[model samples]
Target: MTKFFNSAMAALLISSTSIFAQVENDTEKPNSNPPISIETMAGSRGVMYQLIINKKFQSIPLGFFSVTNAAATWEKEMTPDIMTQAHLTYTLFKGLDISSGMQYTPVYGFRSVAGLIYSYVSPQMLIIVNPKVDLADDLAAESLALIEYRPKINDKLNFYSRLQGMYGFIPKSGIHNRSYIMLRAGLGYKEFAFGAASNIDWYGPIKHNENNFGVFVSALLF
Candidate 1:
């Protein structure tokens, strides 16, 4: 076991160095086309795959693990000079998670729903405080909002700072129902990001706030 652990550590170190070097090189280039975006994260005893695809026909998006115990959604993006795509995610995990509006190009404008809009001036800073809304008879989470601040660290390196506040409310719950707040921040080069993510949920299924924090790396699978 010791030998295997040593080998794994060495391999991870080598891979990190390689990625850092490549990112530097890409930053030095004059201009590079925007890469496709697919977010994948692995850590905290679980893994998440958030692929970006959109279609008019209704069908489930498929990927690794090949099971429905996970969260998955597909989005459609088609641009006629200025293109905008939206995704609505409803699942068994967190009830309903609808992402904010984003702009893929500079030709059009950006829109947001629920809580407050982040920012219209900087285009990179967004702050929101959501109010609870009805999802169903038994399904609901205390109104929650998240602020995502993205900054370009370098030509090839981008840093993402995300903070979310959640107040869980189950109108049909029998007992303890707690609120949760999560912070996920990371740095990405090209289409990959690595960093620390933590989640704390109080008074829910376990009656106590569960704590989960760890290193996570996500890749663009699209």
Candidate 2:
């Protein structure tokens, strides 16, 4: 199990490096700007591992609740902006909020796993909800709520915390459905972040393979 997680983490790092290389830097030039961005997220639950790719487009704005349809209105209000996203999840076990599998096991498949995400991004906070349905033998409808907050601390460092949870409506299970909540809190230094991640699931308050406390790292690949 230790070897399995190590291999997964190594793969995540390798992919991150390649993505960082391919992505053109966005330094806020005086000319054209692209709204597309990519982010990398990886974590472990003892032996179970998860790697996620988060892609989002922010240029196309949804003026649903804004006073004006102008894209600049979001910049002024310091509130949420409407945007679309695609989330890809790969995991060794389905215990985390990201996967829809019913039990804890070694089998992990990416066959029919994908999510559609829409987000409202504000200056100090972000909210995202994803809708997903798997139609294969592993059937599930995964609904998720994700939130992030960054508080003012200093010039180079800030306090940050994120709450992400999901419920799996697997009527195929007949009775028990799957659900999990993952919370992470720590300090952010520029583009790099290290935080403590804690998660709970319906399988029990805690599982044997679950790590009570884990260190998680994330980076804006773009």
Candidate 3:
């Protein structure tokens, strides 16, 4: 099942790229919009297939073990081009969940990540702090802090918001500072979720280099 899903995701990405190329060729000049560029911009789309198997101990108030595998692809336009990461997450917890995972990418090598997530303040909010250690040369370790808030709006709908900040030891090539701000807003209905997010990256003294925003729609099959 995992193999099949991975193959399907690869095919989808190829098709999306082909379509983008055709559109670029058909148009003499591309629009100079935020997302649309005169030159072809690198982008990728893939299905994240995940499988989880877990067992909970009856004696403990909260004790569980689970295994999860996921695959994702990422691409950059002019600099730091194509890459893919696939990994499995092993989780263990008593009262609070502690997860450790490794992401392997052809270009970036393996990145080890450990995180602790806990919920408080009415159980509607979660705080996550993840420190990542990158094995690839020239890249340094980074820390990501995320605060997620989910509130039940009604029986049929809910709202979710996430704020994320990142700081890296070795700054990225093009960008000066490694700090960035991200905001996400989404609505969930049953198994369907739709969201849009914007990322503002700070670079140089002026703090203006590149900003990205995108929208996504997702559905859960099971």
Q: Which candidate leads in lDDT? A: 2
Choose 1 or 3, whichever is better by TM-score.
3
Each model's C-alpha lDDT? Answer: 0.39, 0.41, 0.40
**Prediction RMSDs, each to the true structure:** 17.1, 16.8, 17.5
Q: lDDT rank, highest first?
A: 2, 3, 1
Q: What does candidate 1's lDDT look like per residue over 169-211, in tens digits?
A: 4546533344555567888676577788865655445646455
TM of each candidate vs. truth: 0.44, 0.50, 0.46
User: Counting only residues 3 or more apart in sequence or on different chains, how many pairs clash (N, Cα, C under 3 Å) in candidate 1?
Assistant: 6
In terms of TM-score, how similar is model 1 to the real structure? 0.44
What is the RMSD of candidate 1?
17.1
How would you encode candidate 2's per-residue C-alpha lDDT over 30-106 as one tens digit per residue? 23221322233333423122323332223441111100000111134433212122333332331122422221211
Flag the better candidate by TM-score, 2 or 3.
2
The alpha-carbon deviation from the true structure for residue 178 of candidate 1, after best TM-score superposition, in angstroms, is 5.2
TM-score of 2: 0.50
